[model samples]
Target chain A: MATTSLTTETGGFEVRRLWTDERSRAIIFQLLVVLGLALFIAFIVSNTIANLQRAGLASGFGFLTEPAFFDINQRLIQYTSESTFGRALIVGLLNTILVSSLGIVAATLLGFSAGVMRLSQNWILSRLVTAYVEMTRNVPVLLQIIFWWSILTELPKVRDSLSLGGAFILNNRGVRMPSPVLEPGFGWVFGAFIVGAIATFLVAKWAKRRQDETGQTFPMLWVGLVLIIGLPVVVHFILGQPLAWDMPERMRFNYRGGFNITPELIALWFALSTYTGAFISENVRAGIMAVSKGQSEAAFALGLRPNQTMRMIIIPQAMRVIIPPLTSQFLNLTKNSSLAIAIGYQDLVSIGGTILNQSGQALEVVAIWMGVYLSLSLLMSGYMNWYNKRIALVER
Target chain B: MTDQAFHRQQAELLPQQPAPATTVGIVGWARTNLFSSWSNSVVTLIAIYILWLVISSFVQWAFIDADVSGTDRFACTSDGACWAWIDQRIQQFLYGFYPAGETWRINIAFVLLFPALAPWMFENVPGARYLRWFSIAYPVIATILLAGGLGLTVVTTDKFGGFMLNLTVGLAGIVLSLPFGIILALGRQSRLPVIRILSIVFIESVRGVPLITLLFVSNIILPIFLPPDVALDSVVRVIVMVTAFASAYMAEVIRGGLQAIPNGQYEAAQAMGLSYWKSMRLIILPQALKISIPGVVNTFIGLFKDTTLVIIIGLFDILGIANAMVSNPDWLGLSSETYVVVALFFFIVCFSMSRYSVHLERKLDTTKR
Candidate 1:
C-alpha cells in the first residue's frame, strides 16, 4: 500500500511538471502574441475612427447601390453608365473570369506542347522551344503585353484592313468574326445542348466503368463529341434552323455588323496568355523531367506503344507533379488579368478606382476589394486542396 | 586461329575509318543539329528561309531605311524600324519629367551606388563583412538623389513616377523588405506564440490580395487613416506598400531556408553555451542565407518584374514609359520597336540575375549527394 501511494504521488508530480515545462513556454509566448495583436488592432481601430471623424467622411458599403456614371469599354454582361455600382462590379467580375478562363486554356495548351517539345530528341525543335521559353519568361510580362498591344494597334486601319479569306478582318479595331444571332426556336436548341451535355457525362461514366470491368477501351471522346455536336445540330434543324449569321462588312469608314471584341481585351488576353504560357511551359518541362527515364523505359518494356505509353503511363504521373505549380500559374494569370486596366479593359479594380474617385468612398471601395480578393483566394485554395487530394499518391 | 584473329582485326579497322568530310565542321553541326533526317532537313531549310526573309527586312528597315534623328515622323519613311522617335524621347523614357538640367544627379547617384554594390558582390573586396550596412546606406543616398531634399531642389514624388522611378522603387523595396522578411521569418519560426501569430496574419493577409489592390489601399485609404494634416508623399506610400508586399514573399522564402538547416547545428550551438540570439545571428542565418540565395534572387527578380504594376497607379516604370512613348502621335505606329527595346533591357537585367543565382546555387550546394 505504501509503494502504490508513492507511485501515484510521483505520477501526479510528473504531470504537474509537464504542465509547467519549456513546451508550455510556447503557449505563454502564443498568449503574449495574441495580446500584442489585440493591442495593435485596438490601436489601429481607434486611430482610424479618430481620423475618419476628423475627415468628416462616413465609412460603409452603401456606395455599392449608387449609380455608376462611368462607361466600361468591354463588358461581357449587360452594363451601362446608368447601371448600379453593384451591376458594374458584376460586369468587372465577369470580365475577369472570362479573360482568366481563356488565358488558362490557351496557356495550358501552349505550355504542354512547348514543354514536351523541350524534351524531344529532335535537337532543333527542343532548342527552339527552349529559346522561346527563355526569351518570353525572362522579360517582364507587362512589357510583352505592351508589345503585343502595340502590334495590334499598329495594324492597318479598318478601311485598309487585312481580310483573311473574306471571312475575318484584322485591323486596329480588333479581329472581327461572323457572329450567330439566335432566332425564335433558339430555346429548343439550348435545351438540346443541355441534354447533349448530360448524355456526354453519362456516356463518359459508363465508358470508364466498362473499361474498369472489361479492360476494353471505348472512344469516349469521339462519342462525347458526336453527341454534344451532332445532337445539337440535329435538334437545331428540327427546330427549323434557329440561328442567323451576322457577318462583318467593311463600310466606308469602318467594319460593322458583327459581335466586336475591343482591341483592349484582345491585347490583354494575348499578352496574359502568351506570357503565362511561357512560365507554364517551363513548369511542364520540369514536371516531365522529374518523371525518371526508367519509368518510360519500363513502359516500353511492357509492350506499350509510344503514344499509348505517353498517354496512359507518363502524362498521368506527370500531371501529379505538374498540378501544384500549374495552379500557381493559374493564380498568377488571374492576378495579371488586372493589367487589363492599363489598356483600359475595365476590370474590377479599375472600376473600383473609378467609383472611389467619383464618390470619395475610398475606405468602402478598398474594403470591398480586400473582401472580394480574399474570398477569391480562399475559393482558389479550396479548389487546390480538392485537386491535390484527388491526385495525391496513395501509399500502403 | 590466325585467320580468325585477322578477320577480327579487319572488322576493327573497318570501324575505325575516318568519317566523311561533309560530316564535320559547321556544315556537319547544321546537318546534325538542324537537319539530321529528311523531314528535319525540310524543317531546317524552311526555318532558314523564313529567318533570312525576316532578318534581311528587319536589317534593311532598322539600319538602312530607319531615321536616327528628327523631330517629326516625316523623316522616318524607311521600311525599317523608326529609331528617331527613340532618340527624341530617350531622356523621357529614362528619367520621365525629372528636371532636364538635374538629370546628372541620377547619373552621379548610379555611379556612386555601383562601386558600393560591387564590393558586396565581389569576394575579393576588402572589408566584405562590414558591407552589410552599405545596403542600408545605399538606399538612403539614392532617395536623397532622387527626391533631392538635402540642400538640393525638391523633386516631388508625383513627378517621380517613371522608368527610373520604377527601378528605384523596386530596388528600395527589395533592400527594405529583405531585413524585415528575415526578422518575420525568424519570428514565425520562434517558440513565441505572439510573434508567430502576428507573422502568420501579416503574411497571409498580404499574400492573399493582389499588389494592385494594395497600391489602391495605399493610395486611397492609407491617407484617411493618418492625421488629416499629415500628408505622405505618393511615392513614399507606394514604396511602403511594395515593401510590405515583398517582405511577405521574402519571409516565406527565408523560412524555407531556415527550416532546411540541420537541427544538430542548433543543438551544437546550445551545447557551446551560446545564447539563442548569438547562435541565430552568427551560425543559423549565414547557413540559412546560403541555402536560400537562389530563392532570394528569384524574389528580387519577381520584385523587379512586379515594379511594372506601378503603372496602374499612374507611375511610369520602363514599361510605362514605353507605353507613353508609343501613345505620342508622332510615334503612334512605333510601339513594336519601343517595346522590343524595353523587353531587351528587362531580359538583360533579369537573365543576368538568374545566371548569377544559378552560380550562387552551385557554389552553395553543400548536399552530399
Candidate 2:
C-alpha cells in the first residue's frame, strides 16, 4: 500500500521514463538531427563562399554563354570554335545519346542470343557462351576500349587500307561505308513503308483475335515481313527507283564522299556494347531460369508448339524479370560512354571536363553533370516502371 | 473382362531389349543434345564451324606465329601479337615507379593480403577465429607499409601506382563503405521522415552520377572545402569519393537483404523487450548481412573494376600504367599485348571472386530444404 501511494503521489511522470520513452526519445533525436544538419550545411556553404571569394571566381551559369575555343572532331550539329560552351555541351550530349542508343541495340541483340545459347543442349556451344560472358564481364571496360583503339589505329595507313570492291574502305582513320542518298521520290516510298507498318499492326491484332476465338493461327510473321519490305520496294520501283547508294571511292591518299565512321567511335561503341552485353546476357539467363520448367510443360500440355510455348508463355514471364535490371544496364551504358574521354570520343563528361579545365568552374560543371545524369536516370526508371506495370500479372 | 485378361497377360514379364545403338553412350548423348531436331543439327554444325575458326585463329596469333622472346619491336617478325613488350615492362605493370629498392614493400603487402583475407572469407576453417584480429589490422598495416610512416622512409601517394594502386583503392573502397552503408540502409528504413529522406537523397544522387564525375569532384572540388594551407592528398580524396559512391550502392543492396527479412523476426525481437539498437545489433544485422553476401561481392567486383577510372583523373593504376607504356617510343604499337596483359590480370581476380560468390550462394541455400 505504501509503494503504490509513493508511485501515485508523484505529480509528474518519472524523468527516467521521459528519457527512455521511445516516442519522446525519437522526437528529441530527430530535433537534434535537424539542428545538426542545418549547422553542417551552413558551415559548408560559408566555407565554399569564402573559398570562392579568395579564389576571385564568381559562381553562376553566365559562363555557359561564353565562346568555346576548342574544336570538336565529331559533332551532330554544326559547330566550330566560334560556338558557345552551351552548343558544345549540346553536341556532347547528343553524341552520348547516339552511342548509348546504338550500344543498347547491339548489346541487346548479342546478349539475348548468347543468353539463349547458354541454355542450349549442345555442350560446346553452352560452354563457349559461358566463357564469353565470364571473360568479357570480368575485365575492366577501359582496358577493352584502349585495346580496340590500338588495334584500329595499328591498321595499315590510308594508302594500303583494306577495301571491299570500292563499297567500303577500312583504314586507321575510319571505316568508309557507302552512304544512302535519298532522292525526292523516296518520300513516297517512306510513306508506303509507314502504311505497311500500320497494316501489319492491324493484321496482327486481327490474327490474335482470330486465334483466340476460333483456335486458328495465321502466318503473321511472314505476312508482316512481306507487307513492310515488299510494299516499300514496290513503291520505290513504281516511283522510279528514288534511292541510290553513294559508294565510297578510293582516292590518292584516302577514301572520299561516303559515311566515314571514325575509329574512336568504333572502339568506343564496340567496347561499350561487348562489356555491357556480357552483363545483359547474365540478366537474360537469370530471367529465363526464373520461370519454372512447369510453365513450358503446361503450355506444351495445352497442345502449343515449342515456338508458341516460348512466345506466349515463357517470354512474357521472363520479360517481367528482365526489364528492371535491364533499365539499370542501359543507365550504366549511358554513364560509361563518358569513358570516351580516354579515347577522345567527346561524350558529355569529356566535354564537361574540357569546359571545367578552361573556365575553372568545377562547382558549376559538377552540378551540371549531376543534374543531367539524375534526370536521365529518373526518366529511364519512370518509363521502365510504366512498362513493368503493363506486363504485371493481374490477380483474381 | 477382356481388358483385365490382356493386362494380366502383359504383366507376365518379357525381357526388355537393349536401347538402340544410336540411343546409347556418347553417341546417344550427342543425338539428344545436338541432333534431336533438324534445326538443332544445323545449329550444332554451325557452332562447331565458328568455334573451330575462332580457336584456330586465336592459336595462330597467340602461339604459333607470335614472338615471345627477342627484346625489342624490331625482333617481332610475325604478323601477330608482340608479347615481348609486356615481358620488357612487367616491372612497371606490377609497381609503377616506386624506387626499385622499395619493391619489397609491395611484395610484402601482396603476400600478406591473402592470409589477412582468408580467415574472414572462410570463417569455418580450423583456427580461423584466432586470426580474425589480423583481418582487422591488415588495412592499417598495409597503409603503413605502402605510405611509410612511423620512422620508415615515406613513399608519396603519387609513387603508389600500377596494380598496387588498384588493390589499394579497391580494398579501401569496399572495406570502408560497409559500416557507412549499414547506417544509410538503416536510415533509409527509419521511422523518422527526415532521416529516411536524407538517406534516399544521398543514395539516389550518388548512384545517378557516373564514377568519372565523382572522381572529378574529389580531384577538383574537395581541396576548396578546406583551408588554403591544408592540402589533401589526391589519392585520399579519390578514396573518399569512391567510398561515398560505393556506400550508396551498398546501401541499396543491404536494403534488399533487410526487406527480405520477414516482419515476424522484427516483431519477435521487439516482443522480447529489447530496445531498438540492442535488438538491431543482436538480432537484425547478422541475418541481413548474411543474406547480403552475394550482392556485396558483386558490388566489390564493380568497385574493383571502377578503380581503373582513377586513371582518368591522373592516377596510375594498372590500366593507366599500361596506357602510359603503350605510348613509350620503344614500344610504339604494342597496345594489343599491353592491354591483353591488363585484361588477364583483372580477369583472374574478378573471375575468382565471382566463382567464390557462386560457391557461397550454393552453400547458403539451405532454407528451401
Q: Which stretches of candidate 1 lie over 4 Å from their true place?
A: A1-43, A183-243, A250-256, B1-16, B19-32, B36-57, B119-122, B125-136, B144-162, B262-275, B366-369
Categorize the docking of model 2. Answer: medium
lDDT (C-alpha) at residue B143 in model 1: 78
Query: Alpha carbon lDDT of residue B30, candidate 1?
Result: 76
Q: How far is candidate 2 from the true structure (C-alpha RMSD, Å)?
A: 3.4
Pull out the clashing pairs in model 2: none
Query: Model 2: per-residue lDDT, tens digit, A1-396?
Result: 532221335565565654556676677788888999998878778888899999899899899999999999888899999999989999998998889889989999888888888988877788889999998999988888888998999888998999888788898998999899999989999999999999999999999999999989899989999999999999999999999999888778767888889998999999999999999999999999999999999999999998788778988999999998898999998888888999999889999999999998889988988898889889988998999989987778
lDDT of 1 by residue, A263-362 (tens): 7778888888888888888888888887889988999999898778888888888888889888778877887887777777788877877887888888
Q: How accurate is candidate 1 locally (lDDT)?
A: 0.81
DockQ, computed on Cα atoms, for candidate 2: 0.70
Q: Best by lDDT, which number?
A: 2
TM-score for each candidate, following the candidate numbering: 0.87, 0.95
